[model samples]
Target: MSDTQGKDGLAAATGRFDAALARLDQSLVELTNRVQRIKRIEVDTQRLVQERARLATELDKTSARAKRLDDSAHDVSRRLVVAMETVRAVLAKTE
Candidate 1:
């Protein structure tokens, strides 16, 4: 081949290489952005999971407290009934 033709071929090849490199750079940038977005989503998901766990723990504590309150109410009701029976007996004796 003539020197001129060889030089032209080299120039064309170099241009193609440069274009390919530019495309590669662009793809790398896009990949990096996607990875960053994924990381953020992962962090958000973890936070939500932790919050849900904390709320569940609070709910369990509230349920236990409610159970205790119910038991106390039942005990009070029993005592009130016994007092009323005693009062009725005393009134009958006096009458």
Candidate 2:
């Protein structure tokens, strides 16, 4: 082959290599962006998990407090009934 033909072949090969490199670079950029988005999603998921745990703990404490209040109310009601009965008996004796 002539020197000119050899030079033309080299030039063509170099052009193809440059195009392949550009495509590879673009693919790498896309992959990097996707990875960053996934990382952000993971962080959000972790935050949500922590919030759920905190809310669950609060719910448990509030339920216990409500139960205590209910018990006290019943105790008060029982005491009031006994006092009313005693007053009725004393009144009957006076009558």
Q: lDDT of candidate 1?
A: 1.00
In order, how many clashes per candidate? 0, 0
Worst 10 residues of 2 by lDDT: 1-10
lDDT of each: 1.00, 0.99
User: Estimated TM-score per prediction?
Assistant: 0.81, 0.81
lDDT tens per residue, model 2, 1-95: 99999999999999999999999999999999999999999999999999999999999999999999999999999999999999999999999
In candidate 1, what are the lDDT values of residues 1-95, reduced to their tens digit? 99999999999999999999999999999999999999999999999999999999999999999999999999999999999999999999999
Model 1, 35: alpha-carbon shift in Å? 1.3
lDDT of 1 at 79: 97
